[model samples]
Target: MNSSQLKPLLSIGNKLIGFILFVICAFAIYNKVLQNENLNQYGADLKIQLSKIHWGAWVLMGCLMVLNYTIEAIKWKSVIAETNQFNIFQALRAVLVGQAFSFFTPARSGDYVGRTLFLAPGTKLKGITQMAWASYAQLLMTICFGSLALFWNLPFLPWLKWVAPWGAAFAVGLFFYNQNFKGWLSKLNILQIGTGLKWKLIALAFSRYLVYLLQYNWAAAMLSIPVTGLDLSIAIMALLFFLSMIPAISLTDLVIRGQLFLLLMAPFYHNDILLIALTTLIWMVNFLIPSILGAILLLGFRLKR
Candidate 1:
């Protein structure tokens, strides 16, 4: 077949792959929710909680979700600025596309693949490397906060104390690791942006992390799960840490996140169904929603590969 004939085949193959992955993820999530007998018990209470939620609160949560991704797009755009100038809309689309691919891959590796595809054809490798630097900043925030939470909950299991220091050390390493990459970074002009951008990157990451926690707390309240103050903060740390450190397919993250909610929140709260509902809702609002929107956006996406 001529190259022209191959282009259509390649495009069809790519779309099919994306669609199949989404279906698999949806099936995994659906099966998990269905199998959870605990979740079934909350059917009526879940409805009640939804009814009690102020329309304003729902609107506020939606706004927060928008803010979350907006910040992320800004971060990605800044990282790629040295390579190419991307408008806010392009950055937003790239971020969503990353989320869409992340649904199927382990450790969300597909995120880089999806994002890099939007770069100038030959610059994809540099684009991915820069974008990954941005991700490292976010991961560092997760590790630091998660370690602190682990320290707070460590007394519960004294034998596991070693993990906290290690996590903290890893966070610290992530912060300085950029120094070792200075030569390569200079080649890509990442270092040309100066230390000011370094600080901005860290600040953006932490701010995004806090937004995630705030959204989760809101979701918890909406589900009638009474979580507050330091306890809630610790749970936030634990969830982010656990999710950050683990290597799992995006679909399985829901199951893992749900179990963590049960384990971490069990002492403070007793409603199993509420815990499941809260986790699932947060997942749907934060992750699944982006992926769905990304899928829609992907219909018009041209795959350079």
Candidate 2:
């Protein structure tokens, strides 16, 4: 077939993929909210708590969510600056739509597909490698903080306690030596993200991670999760640590979220409806809401791949 005929077919196919993503996102969200019988029982009380959340905390969570993705957008823009630069609006749009793609895909791997396509046609492929560097920084931050949270706050086996400090040391050392890894990436003729830009990416990722914890803290305080201070931080770090390690489509991860939260918080809080409510709240605020917005954004947007 002629190139012109193929272009039309490709456009139709892209539109179909977008439509399918929206359907999956909608179904996933519906399942996340309605499928939980415990959540249904407490739905009214949760709504009441949401209504009663101090106005200041409410504003903070809203601002944090905005800041969360804004940091994400800027991190993306910074990572790709040397190769393909786009404005903040484009970056933000791409990040949100990437969330939509991540919702149903295993390990959120669809995120690469969703975000990279927004790059100009020539740079899209390389954008994958470049952007992955930025994603790794966030993973690194989770590990670094999780280790510290473990070492400083939580108690462990007499034999295993040393593992926490050692883990933290290793993660910190890895942070400083990240340049060597970057060197390998460049040696392979992968994009040279450069030294300064690498630090910028780490700083942005660290800030985003803190904002993430702050949002959870606010929600926990509002819900009375029965833990506070260092203990609260430990639970959060543990939850984030395991969640990051799990390999699953986020669209079907409501169970994982609940189990992880209960397992991590077992010491500080009893298994109860409120814990369920906290997990549900964070999931909605962090994942489902953004993915829903992303799905809406995808409706008229062109899929590059």
The most accurate candidate by TM-score is 2
Question: lDDT scores for all predictions?
Answer: 0.76, 0.75
Model 2 C-alpha lDDT versus the unseen true structure: 0.75
Q: List the residue pairs that clash in candidate 2.
A: none
Clashing pairs in 1: none
Worst 10 residues of 2 by lDDT: 152-161
lDDT of 1 by residue, 1-305 (tens): 99999988988987676566546545544554465444465567756656777888888889989999999999999888877789988999889878877766788897897787689877787787778778888988888887778777643566555677686786666556544345546565543334666678889999999898888878877766777767877887878887887897666787788878788887688887777778777777787788777766666655555
What are the candidates' C-alpha RMSDs?
Answer: 4.2, 3.6
Residue-level lDDT of model 2, residues 38-131, one tens digit each, is 4666778767766766778767777878899999999998888877778998898889888887877789888898898678878887899887
**Regions of candidate 2 where Cα sits further than 4 Å from its true position:** 1-24, 31-57, 152-161, 164-187, 303-305
